[model samples]
Target chain A: MMRLVLGLVVGVMMIGQVAQAQNQPLRLEITEGVIEPLPFAVPNFVPANAAAAELSSDLARVVAADLIGTGLFREIPSSAYISQITDFGAPVQFADWKAINAQALVTGSISVSGNRVTVGFRVWDVFSDKEMKPGLQFSGTKEGWRRMAHKVADAVYSRITGEGGYFDSRVVFVSESGPKNQRRKRLAIMDYDGANVQYLTDSSAIVLAPRFSPTGDRVLYTSYESGFPRIYVLDVGKVQRRVLESQEGTMSFAPRFSPDGQKVVYSLSQGGNTDLYLMTISNGQSKRLTSTPSIETAPSFSPDGSQIVFESDRSGSPQIYVMATSGGEAKRISFGNGRYGTPVWSPRGDMIAFTKQNKGRFHIGVMRANGSEERLLTASFLDEGPTWSPNGRVIMFMRETQGASGRSSLYSVDISGRNLRPVQTPDGGSDPAWSPLQK
Target chain B: MNLVSKLIAGCALMALAACNNPTDGTDGGPIDPNAGTTSPGLIGDQTSPSYFQQAIGDRVLFTVDQSTINSEAQSILQAQANWLLANTDYNATIEGHADEQGTREYNLALGARRANAAREFLISKGIAGNRLKTVSYGKERPIEICSEESCYAKNRRAVTVLLGGLAG
Candidate 1:
């Protein structure tokens, strides 16, 4: 865990703002109202050598894509550029950018030596004619150029919005194929913006609900490989897996890690009833959290790990409930007109995102921790299993179509219920669990 | 009553047909003496597994999210109980499934309830508790694919899959 601190030591050159903005720096609010996207520009990064020429263009292209994809920023085409950055230390000509209505500008330089690559970038406030933040530099292996590009975009985003960025994150999900009756599912993972797809498990068995650990080192999922539903924990880097709960006769599923990644809370079914159970990850010892004759599953921990929010059917139909981390009487949280299930505590611990069904239509929704100000973010034929972004500003979930030809895909929406975008997978995908921003 | 009588008669006829060549009554295709389908191999010379599946009903239907046994499902499960009691050599694995209308986790728990409901019914009918095992596939394995009630009704089912010659 301490490696995170070391990873942040990327030799930041503490060069203070090259200039000062006479007014406030360029900023945008995450609002539901219709907003004209802030226009920004990123010309090709200046290459330090002939070998770095191709990477320089790609770095700039990736950075621009990451920013524009947020819907809060719009990319101003290079064709609209009046000045090209020939040097990394050159000053920006704000007057020319203002003529084209460019509110923000990003400039960077890339140099490659063998396998190591170094990048330096600065964010400029075009409207104020000054740099918004201190200039920063990042160095990494050539294979991680995309990551460096994303880091650049994240810095630019944070500087302007004064919030954490999510571009350097990944998502774990279930990949599906075949028909509705006999679908084959495999555990799969990919980048936050749907790049670098890699399969974690083959389709030999049905795997569902792949959730990333808090530290992003492992994944917990349910698999039916043993002729029964069981929980499995897999090391993402080693690509190895082991059954977390292998008690014969009883079945377990819907496993989610606690915030600190030291324990797991999941539903274990016995006799005819299902109840939630908590397990210590180190010794495989489990303790019952809820004793009821109803379906209780989809447990999620709050950011501080003092409480858990889960779905239970004690009131006849499935609804959201919150209970203490050590387990006791749970307080029902949802008072809506529908059945709520899969209640996930947001990373910020301020809201809980969930899947709800009302009048035959399924929706992805969110509510305050106390279950107030309920807002439905999406409504479709089938939408379930929501996972929050690391910053809690966005939620990515699964949506399925209807009829015999029904198929599911991953989708994401901002907490404001805007920028409803489909996250592309190589195949049909569902049950997306977003990982934290990687170091 | 009508479907019950018809099913009983069909079972008897199918049991007989398993041992003899079908359509080999007078004026039929060539009647090879050894052309009978697989023998029943029942220890007490009772019904075959196919007969139990097709004519005696090896499955029970559930409506929507409810796992309670209906009057119609009760009658079918009663027939299954009678057959299992007579055939003491086989254990059964009850597979429960749900339609794709709910969340995956809830439907899985729902499926387990359905299987256990059927298993409990059989147990009440004198089938040893150890003779029945249950597993749920949630909405993962649907026998029917359409989203309409026509298919959904069938997809939400509890199927009795017999484990050959294991129970005492």
Candidate 2:
């Protein structure tokens, strides 16, 4: 009996030890508080070679520009910096950074050998006095120095925000000019910050809705060169293009690439009836996806190729619908009072961005995949055609003025319905398509 | 034959042909020599392009965001059909347009519906379908550039343009 009592006592002690080992820090409490932008410092990169002397400082400036543009972070100018970082290998002076009230510090170095260049960068948390992430390096041609800088900024952003970075990306949009009645449209591409502007097509034929391929090598757009709307695929690097083979007496428009980039989904109008169609990019083989008499267009594929989210007027008014890629009945996802169209699925596959019109006002909005938790990000005289940033944290769309001027420009807003701002462009722009992150 | 006698014979033959085929409305209505005097208006006859535009009307309007042809639009379309029937030598191209209110793709499809609605009605009114073609400009081309309802009502329309031939 004494041995049994001793065994019970030992079991109780073991249970107490297990419970104590499972103890964790108290969960963070929910409360309202003032939100302020985080302050960070980006020291000019060290030049390891004579050729990289100028590029080193230029790269650092570009990196700082990217982080500040997001509005989530602020840059502490070099004038306020307590100490300079002269060597990338040297330890970070956390006390100096903390003296300037900087929460994060970014340091890097650049080296140019022959035609190739290498950039290495590191990020540190000042209060913690430790590296935020492992230092990383990128190598590329001398011409791509800016891209490498953007890559460094992207890494820093991802580490700090706990979300993917959109710095290292491109945007393809329709550039507009001339008067409101006879606007001339040309296809133009540039960096996400409106740099490196390149015109892909002239204003001879009207172009609309340029979509980037999954690999960022090609773009799909609708052109009126044949006196009717037809889809054309253009190679970004080669600047060569070819019209997608289509049946005679039919019009095709609103083209989008499948997630895999091997197929295109667009709307085909045959004998006055418009429906959704899927076509292989290589051989021109196509299959009909929707057969309703009503118009079905603006199709976007889910990150996975299993389903598609598109706009259809089959329910009498324009609304968002989700259907299988193989073709089946579409479940209506938008039941709000307003008409919803231009449904684009987010890359994260958690939400779908759309254009909604209600009470004569247009709004850019997002909803969960199953159509719950709808939030309107921006409202304007005319707002439509949303394109998600590479990270899916921001939505870029077209916004137009109210009066007879009828000028249109590209604008972006965070998915959480803040930081609404216009994206700068040389001329009036619309129908922006965000490219995937570069390799 | 003598030169004088031959000339007289030719003149006599021309006079006889002219008498046989009289110029019925060949003057193409009056020259309207006073066209710009009392009023600087309408310098052409019934068959002129300006006359067709001013007298018969070239476009029909619809309600906001709708493609259905109401009674007023149907009356205008009926007049258009009659005019087209009278001018069989000419072909028509119907351009569908929308206001600046809707989404681009939806406006395109709506404009197509408007144009097709008008084309089908013209065909039903005995106008040959082959003589008519339809295209939707969507919201790209706006005749009334203002943003008010007054302008939008005029902007949502289908215009029938005469192409001057029967060829496709």
Candidate 3:
């Protein structure tokens, strides 16, 4: 048995040598950059039935757009392909893809029945001449065809990059219109790529800081309809809402959902003093988390729901702090020269993204959960409210230009401080809170 | 500042003469029905809303990111306090605002501080606490349109809007 194992190890080494002599599999280490993007091709998905003829092709297009938008993968246009994939189950002609320098290939098929749709996809490492992963399929309502496409793209991304995917997600934000003084803000939600925008609230009253629930079925936001800041919870699908009860004279704002969606942590001000409070959603009871005289707000929960991160000015300036979920002695985490606020815990539980203000400039930055290895992504005149993508690989925040004509817009930057791009909205937007990956 | 003050005084004097000349009827025209309706006592009343707004200055300015009242803002609030004291039938809502330079939450808290600072001063000057209410608009309401210091100076202000007062 030992001799057989020895011979197998030697054979594996020889195969590795032969693989290196040929083209090795496409391995992307995110830390290394300036490298060429992986080249891949996705033929228009095949339609399994007459009802799926157009949707199959559209779903493939959306999947391709999702992968290509990452800037890590480049799609070889159909014009450049020498062969077409007519059969989803047929053997892949790796030789043809190899000739075109296509390192990876994705082939998918779609089927529709009634209000249901299904997408099946497979990824192949053409260079290694082998399938990278087992075939996968997703079935959902036809109304959510885009989500099915996102799932397929996410599968391909995770299989290739060895990281979680953020494609199948949503963002809740405050959409602004009109002039600066008379600006009307409403709660708006959209897909991760800023498509399918739906206004959850009207522009009747000013709204700020729309945050998504853990399940993405509801949202928490602060509205001024009551002539003062009050937190309200709205069901995303039903569009029904109710104000969260609090003390009569106190104001509540800057709310975020706990990871379990069972409670909410927010800031409440009374008698000109602000503090953090945690409330159980099942019951209307709330417990004060911080009792300092200084302002305390912008509370976010760690993914495990064991601790809370918030911003406080009790130490003389607004800085990030961490405390037990049940409220106890807090420890300051930000020792930087400038003030810090809006610290959002990454879903991965490794880092926290925040907005830092320093010598006449603002930046969207991230630091380790313990407040180490701090890195700034983008700097501008006014960049605030940093929220992590569902996968924690990207951050979305709001930036406003300087001067009178200044308008707010949403911007995202990769965690590596690259691929900074503006998310186009119908009008000005701010306070983006990215939702978790959709079910 | 001096030029604006002089301009305001000149305008007030012209308004006074305009009020008197309307009653003088030196043009010898038929007695205008509207002339009898023009009551200088009500129009120029020190406790009137227009006088409080145009003459006493309904708003006070604050420095960048700080809520501590300067002497100039204190003088304005002091005059406001005197007005509120003389007109016991009036209640005011102090709306604190910040320029579009800071984070929304921080600016909200800062605006609250500015409003509280003004409110505390008014209370110190014998204005009843129950008569004053405070709210922070926090960079949402900007009176000026520019982004420079001149505009920001106007944007970071606390305006004392009279409410629930006696009828004119």
Candidate 4:
């Protein structure tokens, strides 16, 4: 009887161990894979005063929009809410949100005092029935209410997605007008949502591409004002600019600052030949990095400043090539059909965002550093010049229409190839460069 | 050959007329009757006072990765030279333009090459070197509106615009 009982117990123990092994939660691996967006609800935040009600509502709407735009979350309609959020400090009723199929819930309170405003919010995981992040409070001047709301959204996004936030950012681009043959382009900057636009340069002279320095307080771009293409750097805050290094007998364009912001890398054309050159900002000393007869341009530095990915026709066609930042033999990184150019390394340092032309259609694509796993995010008649969100989860690029009445506009898409939409601009725009999230 | 024979005969008569009346008809009338010998040349030649106003259709298309002018561009240059010879007083500015296909900087270089090619061709055709200037618009301007090959073909061109009036 003892032996029989022991055998039965051992058999049951083995079976239980096998079941436990099978039931163990899978280790979450954050990589280049499909991630279903998390569903959440944001009830209208309550205002402390009547005068603060409208701004509170607007703030809540903007926050929701910003979170949903990241492609990592879906905002549940307020109408579907089972209960209202009357107090941000009160405990979240998990059942209320769970009943409505919401995995997360956001609730906030807005208070305005004299010339200052304060916003307090909390995010909760309804399924886990726990606070996902600490209760956050932001206080600023009444005029800075929108920025405070964006910061809160960024905090919530960072907590839930385990990635940096890009909502509290800005973009600098070229606003274009007139006909195709006589385009007048000006340098323009705006909030990430396309609000608070300010033109930095007049359209008197043609401008090509504008890139933001790492600090977001300056912009480097190419202009044709001196009867030749040359690079210029503008102080965004002061509206002052100076030509970087205008060498005679050579035309330069496609300027990008080094990650350290100490140098500018651009292409210079002389004797009917083009090559990559680097110019130090302090001394204006320029060095030729590429000496090939083949065309080399559109150079972007790696996040670590070790390598550079640029477009070169050394392969007999326009393709992306990677080389050491110190300049060496370049290895072709784009082998897929069609041509690829304008490669910008992501801030995360994992993938490169570029414009790919195949089958007469242009696509914004992301590929690993080694040129594997190419995934195209958006396609159009003309989609080029991709700039990455600070988190590297999204790409912003310009899409141009075809034919005589054609126009260019800004659009962004997630790396998962979803949420493609036009970013509103006061005018037609192109060559969008997303600035890092402001401090 | 037949047109050449007729032109030579006309030139002989004009020479004889100039010998008879050297100064009276030299100022206003057509002293050289051979100038009107070819109707197409006459009309085209009159519109341009110097080589600057003369339009020779001197344009070139670059290959996908090339900035060099090929053989077909040479033929266009030969014709441009003939037109420049007929109209001597014009100074020309060769504006180089590229298709919207390559990077902006590379296209600028490519456009410059196209302009240089045309400029060199004119110089080789015996046009004064100082009479020509070159500027490149890169891929900024496109004469064709479409994004297809047909439009690209028209965009890769070097246009010679007259800067000054022909010298009398």
Q: Judging by DockQ against the true structure, name the best candidate.
A: 1
Q: What would the per-residue lDDT of candidate 4 be over residues A100-208, giving only the tens digit for each residue? A: 8787777777878887776777766677666654566767777667676787788778777677888878999999887777677999998898977999999988888
* RMSD, every candidate, angstroms: 5.9, 12.8, 9.5, 12.4
Q: Against the true two-chain complex, what DockQ does each candidate achieve?
A: 0.63, 0.45, 0.39, 0.35
The model with the greatest TM-score is 1
Off by over 4 Å in 1: A1-20, B1-46, B166-168
Compared with the true structure, what per-residue lDDT tens digits does model 1 show for residues A1-439? 1121112323333433446557676888766688888899998999989889989889999999888888889998999888888877656778899998889889888888998787888888888877775667788888878888888999998887788999989999999998887788999888898998999999998899998999998999999899789999999999999999988888899999998899999999888789999999999999999999889988999999999999998999999999999999999999999899999999889999999999989999999999999999999989999999888888999999999899999999988888899998999999999999998
Residue pairs in collision within model 3: none
- Give me the displacement of residue A126 in model 3, in angstroms: 1.1
Q: DockQ score for model 4, please?
A: 0.35
Task: Give me the overall lDDT of model 2.
Answer: 0.80
- lDDT of each residue in B89-161, candidate 2, tens digit only: 5567777889988998888888888988899999988899887777777888787788899989988998886
Local lDDT at B165 for model 1: 41
- Residue A272, candidate 2: how far off, in angstroms? 3.1
Candidate 3 wrongly placed segments (more than 4 Å): A1-26, A32-34, B1-43, B166-168
Question: Candidate 3 docking: what grade?
Answer: acceptable
Return the TM-score for each candidate structure.
Answer: 0.91, 0.86, 0.87, 0.83
Best by lDDT: 1
Winner on TM-score (1 vs 4): 1
